[model samples]
Target: MSILLWQIEQHLENHLACRFGHLNYCSLRLLQEKDMVQGLLKLQESEKTCSGCAIGKSHRSSFDKEIAWRASQPLELIHSDTCGPMQSITLGGNRYFLTFIDDHTRMCWVFFLQHKSQAFNIFKRFKNMVELQSGYQIKKLRSDRGGEYTSLEFSKFCEEMGLERQLTIAYSPQQNGVAERKNHTVMEMARTMMHEKKIPLKFWA
Candidate 1:
């Protein structure tokens, strides 16, 4: 019985010394209260830095306040993004999809594609359809620095059409928040609907 108690004490002491010694006493106490660690009584102050603790506690700076996009007219500005090479192929054999969002109306258009190369053609079709319907041509398109939007053919088409291309910086999705948020909403809604209707995974085209 004494040996068992001694083993427990050693384990607890080692845990404090090696694992969670970097944390202050209050945090250690809280962790003990939550039963995250067994037999933690207190933390001893030490000069040594805990590499794991330093990494775990480090955080990136918060993003700057968002500047909302305000368009005066439909098709004046459009935000676009492409999502997935999904894990499962859809019934239509499409593995990827693209989305376009109008900044003014918040209207969205979705197109399914089997390859990324299809994005430029899809955008052309979308532009014609929306312009014909609304009698307003697209002025500016804002999207991430995707190869589909940066291709020579895509750039030439935009130039000929007098459409301004606004590409977000690499690795910056927040700069294209409208389309990103719309895509997220669409995905979540689709997931919920599929769950409620018990729709098969293949039908999620």
Candidate 2:
């Protein structure tokens, strides 16, 4: 194990400029022929090494079943979700962001909010915008069972508007996979763009 660690350290030092901790899990795991954690710990003498690999590599299971896309047109089905209370608050004191995505075109709408309750108003705006732009009524809407989406007001609005509302089974994010995945993508992109532009971390609102 020590020998393997030495070999990895030497190899990484030659090709990489950053500390071992900065390299991603995949890169570090290459040091081990098998048993990722065992391989990394053999080189534990260096405090400079990133321990992220040891922790991250431990998770090997595949994701839950993906929700099947069943709609054909833009407004035929829409997926809605909200993310955050970002680790850092935005300049305007906004902490949450809502996103609505069309299952067909993959187009999305982003709205920043101070609370999850704002999801209701965002949905209203998105429904109005899409209906006007495409001249097609929303046929179905899908989201997690967050109170924001399942509230009496929300239910009444959907019923009155004649739109079908679908809620994923409790604790089953994969059942709302489209919106769940898009939420991660948007936040990841936001994080990358914010860092690249040197935007203040708080402006994620």
Candidate 3:
């Protein structure tokens, strides 16, 4: 049998701290007190400060409540987001829901899915139904750089359709605020309705 050497001292303090999401001083100290990592307390030396933790934990100002631009026509732009792994499953066995909002009309459509992988296919289905009904070709799509939106298949499909993509900055959901707020509003409404009617959460979809 081979034995592993933790070599806690050989590793840099910042690296270890980052591994546990840049844990705070108390957290690190607790680890030492619990002997989770023997000698880990040495890294807490005054000289070994974590810069990443300082930067990452820094607070940013709030986003503007109003959007600077709005689509001039229906389907000019679509804001989409996937929300879930709900606390309870839907009637169709779905635990997730994806939403697409028309930027100009503020119209929102939702689709349920059992897995996140179904998101791309649901987008295609939504595109087909809406384009057929509205007779307006979607010019752009906006979403976070979720794997469902960034997958090779999704990118290729958008390219083939000549659709523009707007991705949010890393860790910034405010860039996709429309979809985020829509989901928030929807959740609040659903919860309020369930409370009023004594409906179960499984009907959230």
Give the best candidate by TM-score.
Answer: 3
Clashes of 1: 0
Model 1: how far is 66 from its true place, Å?
2.6
Model 3: per-residue lDDT, tens digit, 174-201? Answer: 8898898777655654554455456787
Write model 2 residue lDDT over 1-205, tens digit each, in one string: 9999788876665334133423433444455446644424333233343333333333333346565656787789988888877888777778888888888877788889988888888888888887998998889998989999999999999999899989989988878877887676555545544544567778666
TM-score of 3: 0.68
| Candidate 2 runs further than 4 Å off | 1-69
Model 3 alpha-carbon drift over 4 Å, by segment: 1-64
lDDT for each of the candidates?
A: 0.76, 0.71, 0.78
- Distance from true location, Cα of 147 in model 3, Å: 1.1
Stretches > 4 Å off in candidate 1: 1-65
lDDT of candidate 3? 0.78
lDDT score, candidate 2: 0.71
Top candidate, metric lDDT: 3
Worst 10 residues of 3 by lDDT: 1-10
TM-score per model over all chains: 0.67, 0.67, 0.68
Error of 1 at 177 (Å): 0.3
